[model samples]
Each structure stands twice: as C-alpha cells, then as structure tokens.
Target: MKTDADAAPLPMLYRLYTAGAQIASPILDRMARKKLQRAGVSKARLHERAGVASQERPLGKLLWIHAVSVGETLSILDVIKELRQQAPRMTVLLTTTTTTSAELASKRLPEGCIHQFAPLDTPAATKRFLDHWQPDLVTFVESEIWPHQIASVHDAEIPLALINARLSEKSLMSWGKRADLARALFGRFSLVLCQTDPVRDGLRAFVQEPWKVVTSGDLKKSSDPLPVNDLQKARLAQAIAERPFWLASSTHAGEEEAMSAAHKHFVAQHADGLMILLPRHPERGPEIADMLRTEGWRVAMRSKDEAIAPDTQIYLADTLGETGLFYSLSTLVFIGGSFVPVGGHNPYEPAHMGCAILHGPLYANFAQAYADMAEQEASMEVADAAALGQALCALWGDDEVALLQANAKFYIEASRNIRKDVAGHLLALIAP
Candidate 1:
C-alpha cells in the first residue's frame, strides 16, 4: 500500500489507477475537441527512439528544462538564452506539455536546444523518456512537478531544480492532503527557486529542508519584451489610426462579456474608440464573436484577417503568439481573466508595452507584481464590469491620463533587468 511518494516503486494498485487515469483522459480529450475545437491539445507520445538517437551523438552535458505552456516557456526563455551563452557546448533539452508551447518554443529556442514532448507520468513512459534524454540536470519551470517524473530523475541520479515556482492556495490545500507524499517528491529537488515570499513559505511547508527553496522573483517580470517587427507595427498603427483603443488581452470566458459591455460603454462616449479583445484561448474566438455580435456590436475576428474599420466596435484578436501586437497598439490595456475566479493573465506584457493598465480584483497569481503596480499607480483594479467600463471611459476621455501611462512605462523600463538577476542566480544553482 505504498503511496507514490514512498521511495519504493509505485505499487500494482497504483499502476492500475494510473492506467485508468490515462484511459479516462481520452474521453476528456474527445469532449475538449468538441467544446474547444482548435484549442484542444492531444497528449503527445515521446519519440523515444529519436531521443535515444540524439543521446548517442556524444553531446556534452545536457540541461533539461520542462515548461508547461507558453507562459512558462516564455518566462524561462531568457534564462535558457543566458545559460547557452555561458556554456556554449552544453546541450539543452526543452520539454513542454502542450503542442502550442512546443511550437512556440521551437520557433524561439536557440541553436543548441532540442524541443520534445514531456512523457506522461506512467512509470514505463517516464523511464523511457529519462533513458533516452539522459539529462544531467533537470529544471522545471513553475510548478509542473510530476511524481513519476521526479522519481525517475532521482532514480537516474540527476540534479533537479524548480525555477520561478509558485503554488496556488487551492493547489497547496490539495497537496496538504498528502503532505508526506508532497515532501518526499519535493525533497528530491536540489533547489527550488521560488518567485515570491508567499511561494517560498508554501514550499517550505511541504519540503523536508526549508532552506532548499530560494526567493528569486517571478521570471515573467524579466522576460524580454515580445518582439514587434517594424512592418507589423506600422500595419497595426495604420489599422488602429489614432482611434482611442483599449486592449483586453488574454481574457478568459466570463471576462469577455464584461469586456464587451465595457467596449459598448466607451463607444457611447468616443464614437471612434476600439475594444481589442484577445481571448486567452484561441478556440473561444468564434464563440465570443457570436456573443458580441448578438449584443449589436460589429465584430472583426483577427483569424479572418478582417481589418478594424471605422465602425468596427470590437476587434477580436483570435490568433496565437501575437499578443505583443495587440499590446503595443493599445494606448491602455486590461489584463483579463481576473473578473471571475480564473486568477488572471500576465499584466507585465502590457505594462512593459507602456500601456495604461487595468485588471479585475482576482489577481492572486501575480499578487506581488500587481501590488507593486497598484502602489505605484502603474495599474488600476476594477471591482466589477461596471468599474471596468468606467475605467475605460475615463482613460478614453482624458488626455491627462497619459501621466498614468508614463508611470507604467517607467515601471517596466526599470524592471527589465530582473531577467539578468534571475539568470545569474539560476546558473549558480545548476552549474556550480
């Protein structure tokens, strides 16, 4: 009856449980495909044979980075770039959970890094993946701690670290249920680089050695500004054309309706105002457009290459990996997903883009960053949809609000070097 955390291998019953879980995932996958369409990601099988072939090529020391999604991948991109520059001969293995993450990582990864799908938590798959990659040092971005994967790395006698790690209250509560198991799994890591004091405190509660966790600030703060080519900037500028525009970027399900309402409110005041809605998930684009259209707003979906005409009320930024475009074009930006209990999307991107910022009240995920911005008057928090509309209207009507925009610009400018600070800390941990 040994639990997964016990050093002893997962037991037969646990194996059956894991197998059942894997089988159940396909049913969820089918449902996701029906409900989410293009946003649904199928589980990827590890290319064990190909991985083994690459391992046999006599590559030098391998450093493996596992990032779950686009955010995590982008968060650690600077660190990866820095690590490569410092150790030119070191081979890097990048693993991601989703196909979108993998695709984005593939496009952005430097010359020496190889991208692969991380294996499922099943023992056999984990073992196969570990056997092929033979990573010398393993670092996970954020909190994607897989029990079997950590155990497999420990079994392989490889060093492990968790960088930019943060645990939500809900997640911490779930782990508290199996504290002993959590401790055992987390104890295998040589270091846990936490993002903030709260994250460090949470990890300390579950780990055997409290000092193993270090606070290094969130890596999201340090990410290089999203690249905007000159052509794209000009095109976006031409499309926007001095229209008072506010971007609701990385919006979640409940937030879109709120944004649509806010857009209508702004339109009432400034007839030339634009509301650019970037849903967090691309699949939600069509659905959101339909909803907005139903509300009598003229909608232009980005995927359809529709231009934002003078009368277009809402521009649906429905594509992937182009949030930068929307953020840059925006005079003011609202970080979405906070209106409901979805935690919130990253505000740093828009802040860094020098746009006046607004977000909903629920931003526990980026609490520290948001607190700093709020204190500095670099960002504003709205209580509900009504406040959201009010904030947008005020910013659109007044030219003096540009002072608040300047504060946001200054905040981002001053903090851009956080990546260098974090990269230095991470390298010392891994290579030292």
Candidate 2:
C-alpha cells in the first residue's frame, strides 16, 4: 500500500524528468520505430512502441509485468508460470523493450501470458498502455525506473511492485544525489521483493516504509533449466563422440584471448579436446574466429555451420538460443565476463545443467550467489588463463566433475521455492 507520502506531489526533479519525456516523446517514438524496423519488426508491430496494442488485452483480472531486456525477461518466466497455476482466472501481460526478448517470449512464455514491446517512457505512451490494459497489478523487474510510467501507475491507483529488485552501487550513488526524486519514484511501489539484502537496505532509504522492501531470494535461481533442442544436441553429441571438451561461455573481449591461451594448455594435454567459445555478443563470431586462427587454433564457427573436425581446436558457438545444448554436452564450464571488468554472466545457468562452474575474480554483480556456491564447493574462481587451463585439466576426470556438478545441483535444489514465495507476494498485491 500506498500511503499519504506516496500520494504527495511529485518532486521537482521527477517533474522535470516527466516534462522532458513529454517534450521528447515524438522524436523518441520515431527513433524507437526506426529501431524496431531495423530489428525486423513489422510495420504493424512498430506501433507497439507507442503503446498501441497489437492484440486485444485479455479479459478478467490482468497482471502486467515489465522487464527491461532478455535477462530480466528470462528471470521472470517461472514466476509467471507460478502465477498462472495459482491464479487461473488471471491473464498476464509480459512487456519487454527488446525484439530479441519478444522473440524469446513467443517461444517460451506460458499459456496464460501475453507479450508486448514496452512503451517508450513518455507520458502519453504510458497513459495509452495503462488505459488499454488496465492491469489489476503491475510489476517492474530489476531497476526499470521510468518517471512517467511510475507516476501514471500511481495516478491510476494501481498497486505496483518491483520484483527481483537489484540496485548496483553505481545506481545507488546516482539516485542518492536526488533523494526527493528517488523517494518520489520509488515510494510509489506497493512492495519491493529484493534479490539481495544490500539492495533491500539501499531501497529502504527511498521508500515510504522500510517494511515494503523485503529481501526475497533471486527468482532466476528458481527458473527452469535453459531450453535445449534435442535434435541439435543429439547431432552434436554424435559429432563430438568420445572427445574431451569444455565450454567458455558468454565471454567478453580480453577474456577470449585468455581462454585461447588456456585452450593451448588444454590441447597440449589432451590432443583431441575441443574448446567451445560462446561469446556474449554473437555478432563478433567472425572476429573471434579470425583471432583464434591467427593464434594457430583451427576454429570452427557455429554460425557458418563449420563442422567440428578431428583437428578443430576451438568451436566458436556464436549463434543464439543454443546455450542449453552446449551446457548439456559439457560438464566442465567457464562462465565468462569475470576475467574482464564485466561483472560476470549467470553461473546458475550452467550450474542448473550440472556443469562444474569456473570464473574469474570480478563477479560483484553476483557476489552473493557466487559466495553461496563457493561455500557449497559448487563453483571455482580462477585468476587468469593459466589457472583456468589448470582448473579445466584437473576437473576433466569423472569424479572431480561429478562432485562439483552434484554440489551445484544441490544449491539449485535448495532454492526451488523462492519464485513460489515471490509469486505469492505478487498475487497478494492484486486488487480485491
């Protein structure tokens, strides 16, 4: 619940933000349309960015969820499923801002859910969206703060919540400078189910009541294992029969070079071992493949359908939506973005598939999750390419890999109820 404080006038900074958004709406709408077109969104769908619905909102109690992009969208899938099971009469509208996420939603969202491109953060666009959907409850996943959107929801007297709410230190410092605006924007949320205690504590500073920010567990932990294409997995398994291999997934710029050096060490030990390089951005496939070739590694680019020949040292899996297939095939996995300054990709993804997880020192974004996994001996952190190679070489044995996989799976099994609890909280927020 919203209190008198939440109902107060918007702060000066928030007013300025809303005013600026209103003034820039037209230009922003045009830019969003152009981006959608470039992303291959049809002319009919382009209007979605302007809060024009592509399909009629389903009748009955509708719960609307807004996720910023792919990661956030994936994180909430289980929650939506849980909500559907518990509230069979309710229809869920899942809105995301990226075309890739929309495509994923088309394939993955549960039966009761509807997917849409989120409106541009402008007064008119948000107003149109809310007026059309008239969601009974609204949720914003993970730091998607738009002043116009929040104010419009509050003005509509809707109960809004922030689930899996995470706040980075950088974001805190930035918002901390404008306490009034922060309060105005954040206080409107009826509840905040935080992923971490630090984020909950930090957000309490901006909310009307400290009790509103509860430290609920990360919903991603409860997400189902990444989807796999059985046909593709089987084909790859046949092609890679009886060969030692490990994956270096979601890698970044400098991390690829490090992994290449590690692969050199790997091949020196097991001549037939394959190193699968899955970059965070797949468009860099050609560049990474070229770099590997220059370094004397025979690279097979997945996008080009290059076969993993007997002599192929690095199989660059640069295509999208195949992470699950690779993880299913490899027991030893190095989750990248940690070797570089990037705060690391999700270790849970690999862990859920029972892949023994490895990473570098820099994973502050997932510090708590990593710490928990480390305590259970579910994950290992390597300092550099040499250490990564050594760790992989050591973990190649069946017993070593099995232990890590068991511990990681145990961690996942223990957290199975987090999303259920979150779903309960969200359901409670629905209007009576």
Candidate 3:
C-alpha cells in the first residue's frame, strides 16, 4: 500500500463525485431515508446508515465486509462461517445496503458477528464508520465500489480485497471511459478475484496493473443451497406428488406475465401440471396472485396460508427464505428475474440445489454461473414467452431430468474449492 501521501489524488471525476456527496450529505440523508422507506428499511435502524453506531464494535481484531444486497450476501455466509471457525479471536462486522439483505444476514452470519447497515458514501460518514470500527482487514463483495469508502480504507493502508467481482456490458463501458479513475479506484484493493473472464479482462483493460485481476470461481457456486426445513420439504412433496411441475423462482415484474403465458400453454398438455412462481419480492405476493387468478389460473399463495389443492395449477411460494424447499419439489425450475429487463437474480440457487434450470437471455447478473452451466448443458436459455413455452414442452416431452440434474450438480462441484481458496488468501493477508 502507498504511504506518505503517495496515493494518487482522486481522479477529476471521482473528486467531484466525493465533493458533491460531502456537500449534500445532509440533504442526502433525508433522500436516502425516503428511498429506504419505499424499500421497507426499518425505521429504528436508520441511524446506522448515517454513521451512528447501533451496537458497540467488539474488542479484538475485526474484519469488516461489505455485501451490497441479498444475492451478494448469500455467497459470503459460508465463507464467513469458515473464517470465524478458522480465526476464533477475530470478529466479523458484516454490512449490507438493503433491508432484505440485513434480515438474511441477521440469521446466517456466524455467531458473534455483527450486522450493520452500511454508511452512505460521503467523506465524513466513511471516515466516521472506519474510525469507529477500526477493522483489521476490509473486504467488499461483488463490484460494490464506493469512492469515499475505498479512499478511506486505502488512505489508512488497510488490507483490502474484493471477491466475486464482475462487470456487465454497461459497467464495462462506464469504467472504460475513464481509465485513470478506474485504475485509481481498483488499485486500492490488495486483491480482486473476478467471477468471469469478461470481468477479469475488463478490469485488466481499465487498470495499469493487470496482475491484480484473475478469472476465478464464483462464490455463489460454493454457497450451500438455500436452506430448506426437512419437514416443510416433505409436506410440499406429498402435496404435489406425481404432478409434472416447473418453477419460476425469483421472478420480476415483466417476467411473471411471460411465465404465466408459458404455464397456460404447458397446462394444456399436462392436465395435472403445476407451476411454482416465487416473485423476487414476496410483498408483491397478493398482486401477483391476483394477476394470475384473473387469467383463469387457480393460484395458491404461501403467505396467505393457502394450501395447494388437487386442482391448484400454481403454487405461489411467496414467502421469503424458503426457496430451497420449493426447489426440491420442482422438476424444472426456470431461474427468473431474467425474462424481464431487470438483470437476473443469482442462478447459483437452483444450481446448488441440483435442479434442472432454465432462464431467459437477460441473466447477466450471474453470467459466469450461467456460462458454466451452458458449458456442461446444465441449463437452457429461452428467448421469450413463446420460446419459453416451447422449451417447457420439450422438457416435459423427454425424460432428461436425470441428465440435467446431474449436470447442475457437477457445475457446483467444479467450483466448491473457491471459498477455501479465497479464505486462504484473506487469512494470509491479515495474518497475525
């Protein structure tokens, strides 16, 4: 790490960015709260984001990790657990941006670890949070780069790493436009493990030192399948026994309508067919259920305490954090949030569960996971509703479930060592 004012000045654009954030920090707080309110952030917890401590930092060496949201958080819990067991004296401070991520982190973070809402990216807030926590090592999950936060850590000479870093086409163009800014921002990290070749290549092109970038295994591939209660899985299995079923997991606004169209066509061929539709936001359960009901489908919502009757065509697994249970009951799980414009959700959930997976063409969020799946024929990508319907019919027509399931399992196994390898590097960096 650079010392004695050797770090480059924030590039022109980033300097302006930080200045703007600092200048508007007060107004920004109110606007942020409004945004958080719309997203269901807890009112009591709003102080944390303003760089106020809700809980005292534990005594001893601390590792502060930033996982931007639920999908990014999911990939790191297993690693965090392993790190906790490996270093008993070290405490983990996990920070997330969204309410849903905070909720999941509270349950899954290892014992003694603290979960806090990440501070907004203003100079003062970043400094206050850094000074209070005094983390021994800092890690950012995925590509959640905050200019002020990175600057604070770098200036302090903290050991920093970025895991599962990725770059979409839009992200690539944005970074590529300012080489000096990109390199200055990225160079602060002691290590960067990219999830895909394109991301690795993009970083190399953006930065002067290409050595920091590597095409590495995605953390999601190593995550445990979404947790499922055994009793719950068994009950669901019995309820949907001997029925040809497909699932549309983690769907978005536009994609559900498309999947419903496909389901209507699919049910015509298989009378007892059922489709499990789990929207990306479970709060929209009523809206989604009502939308399908008006289309002449018998829909049962999980949140509403509706059970799947014999004639129920769609079982809406509309609750949070039980996706794994439904995965066990599904023969064909269409990884959703892709059929629409919103970049797709994590594909690793279905892959980790050994479910036969399908998705739309827009699944850029988990590009590496999907790429690996495609390489091994573990999943299929459909073009649109009509194409998705045809693909569903094809899966129904053939006895390829065994083959698809095996391939999905194989893809996950291929990357099982990623977490250990990443943890090894992290431990060495912050070794006592």
Candidate 4:
C-alpha cells in the first residue's frame, strides 16, 4: 500500500519489529494485563482488548475512528455527528485506548454508533479485530499509531485518513532520525489532514507528498464546549451565592504548589475568593490533596464527599468527566499544564465556554490555539503565582470579566467552520 508520492524508503527495521513481536508476545501480553490494573478495562468487555468482539458487526460502510483518550474522543464528536448526518448509511465505530475514554464514548457517541476498547497492537490481536470489524475507512485522531494495525489495514486495502494530525517537536526530531521508518508508517495514510502548516511540513518531509496532505484546522475549535449539568450547575451557583471564584483546571505535578500559593495570595486580597483546582489525572488527587493541606489551605476533597463550605479555601474536584461543570461556573479559568514543563491541556475547551482563559508561559502542545486567543486578547499568559494572583484579583469585577468573556466568544466564532469543512473532505474520500 502506497500513496502517489515520493515516499522515503521503507525501513528494514519494520520486519525486525514484527519478528520481535512474535518472540516477545508473552511479555507484551503481561504488560497489557498490567494496564488494566487501574480499572481501565471492563470485566464484561475485557475480551475487546484482546481483539475479541462482544457485539456483532453492523452491516454498512463502517467509518472506524481511533482516538486515544477523552480529549481526542471529544474533539472528533462534532465531525462524527456531521458525517453520520451527511451519510445516514454510514455506521460509526469509535475506539479509545483508556477505560475512561470508552465510558465517555458510550455516553457521547451518536445513535447507532458503537464504542469499544482498541485492540492491543500485536499482529494476531489486530488481525483478529480487523478481520471481524472489517472497517471500510479508518481515521486516527491526533498522533496515535500502532504499526501492526496500520500495516494490516493497508494490507486489506483500507483507505486511511489522519484528521487533525500532529507531531510534537520531540516526536518530529526523533522521527527525522529514522526517516525510513517514518516513511513506512506515515506513507500508508491515503490522506493526512494536519492541524498546522509546520505539522504538514514535517509529514511532507517524510511522505514527500503535497497532494495527500492539507491543513484541516483544529477539530477541537469546532467541538461544543464540554457539557455541564444544568441542575448541578444551578445548585453550585446558589451554594456559592455570588462569591468571587476562579478555576485552575487540569493542574499537573509541579504546578500544584504554585497554584495553591497563588490561590492563597489572591484570597488574601479578596476575602471570599475561591479556587477550584482540578488535576489532569484524577489518580493523583490524593497527592495534590496532601500537598495543599500540608501548606495550610482549607482543602475540601470531592472524592471524600466534601462540598464547598463557606470557609473552604480550595475545592478539590478529584473525579473524571467533571471538568465541564467547573468551566461553566467560572469565567476566569486557568489551564494548568502550561505552568510547568508538561506542555498544556486543551485551553479551547475553556475558550469555547467563553472563559477568561489563563495560562503560564510554556504551552507548546496547543501553541497555535493559544496564539489565536492571545491575538484576540481573549486570554492572559501569566509568568508565576504573583502574576496569576494579581490578574485574578483585577478580573473579579463584572465589567472586566464580561469583556474577557466577550473576547473569548469572538475567538470561538472566528474559528468554528473546521468541523464542517473537514467532514466534507472526509465524506468525499469515503463516498462510494
């Protein structure tokens, strides 16, 4: 399987890889089992990870989408819904790597669409899975790649499209070193719709094709703001009773201490101000709780059934799939991963919610999105706790908050056509 481009030579290392998989299958299987230790796989549907199906294949052109996690899954929801509406006969199959993603897909996927755990990336498992599902067209979101699965799909002459495709700076440099391997993998895609020009350039250097690749715009920009429960939102609003609040969402390891200190600084100036801190990984909730408590903050853990009391300084929302609720309650929302070197989580989610988006200096992961926001004056990039605290204090007034939110709304409106645009190109490719 090849595109009509001058692809770099396929690497000799690929054959060695599959051959190695053959010998190390047992060890790999054990690792796969260990992955489920944290309740990521359902006991009833556990076989799905082993390339066994619990549901029979639906008859139609199955447009299979493989997105790795909650972010990727949510980003493509609008695209999938548009495609399903445009071509009613198209049955959608969405697969994710994590149990949280699978649970999310079950709730969010459109009617008639199926959600399943992705099969393990070994030849036997992938073959068993693909042979059963027999997807007509396969799409991968972001940068998830499984060598054997990709090869098997191409071997069966499936049309592959990579939507909102991206590679980090580190990934691009590493792949450049292994040009032969890069070409072997990237060349198999019939189309690669990259998020930015630089990403398109990096892919072009490997596949060496202009025709198969194009800038599709970021799919996330078009997704609906993460959903919030209206009743819960109303209750939270009443309980707080017009208190000034800001959210530091999806905080990672190093940034936790800084954010806690920042919250304390702001609270010193504004007595009733509160900070709702949400960790990126809920599993680290305990560690964050311990750290904040030790630092003398009145921390209330969501997992422990603690609510935002009148005296509660830091409200710790330590659970899955609840970021949307907090996004709805606050206008000044700081996306956390940027504060440290962990790249950044998607600020677009908050931007779409019309947040007065806040970030630290480091935000390479979603750099283009942040740049767009900054250009519109829709967001603020703070350097440290002092800056973040001061900004929060200044923005507590109604007029300033409204102004920032207006800018965010403008940014969202300016960049919304990507889902429809990308869906049109995808439908064209998959059309019979």
Best by lDDT: 2
Instruction: Give the per-residue lDDT of model 4 (tens digit) for 129-190.
Output: 89899888888898987777777777778878899998887889998998888888888888
Give the 10-residue window scoring lowest on summed lDDT in candidate 2. Answer: 1-10
Taking the tens digit of each residue's C-alpha lDDT, what string does model 3 give over 1-432?
332244345788998998899999999777767877787767776767877767888899899999988878888998898788888789999999888898898777878799988999998778779989988889998888888888888889887888888778798899878767887888777778888888888777755567767766788878877778999888888888888889988898877899899997788888898998988889999998888999889999899888989999999988977888888777788888787777777777777778888889887787767777888899888988888888887887487877888898888878788888877777777857
Candidate 2 displacement at residue 53 in angstroms: 2.0
For 1-432, candidate 2 gives per-residue lDDT tens digits of 342343446888787888898999999999999999999998888989899998898889999999989999999998999999999889999999999899989998989889989999898899889989999888999888878888888888888899998878888889899888888888888888999998988888887688988998888888899889999999899888899999999999988999998987888889999999999999999999888899888889999999988888889999998999999988899999999889988988888899899989999789889999999999998999999988888888758789999999999988899999999999888756
Candidate 4 at 389: error in angstroms?
A: 1.3
- Candidate 3: list runs displaced more than 4 Å: 1-7, 31-45
Model 4 CA deviation exceeding 4 Å by range: 1-9, 33-44, 398-400
Reference-based lDDT, residue 183, model 1: 73
Q: Show the colliding residue pairs in model 3.
A: none
**Candidate 2 lDDT:** 0.89
Model 1 gets an lDDT of 0.76
* Top-TM-score candidate index: 2
Q: Look at candidate 4 and tell me the lDDT of residue 139.
A: 88
lDDT of candidate 3 at residue 415, scale 0 to 100: 78
- Structural similarity to truth (TM-score) of each candidate: 0.86, 0.96, 0.93, 0.92
RMSD in Å for all candidates: 4.9, 1.7, 2.4, 2.4
Summed backbone clashes in each candidate are 0, 0, 0, 0
- lDDT, candidate 3, equals 0.83
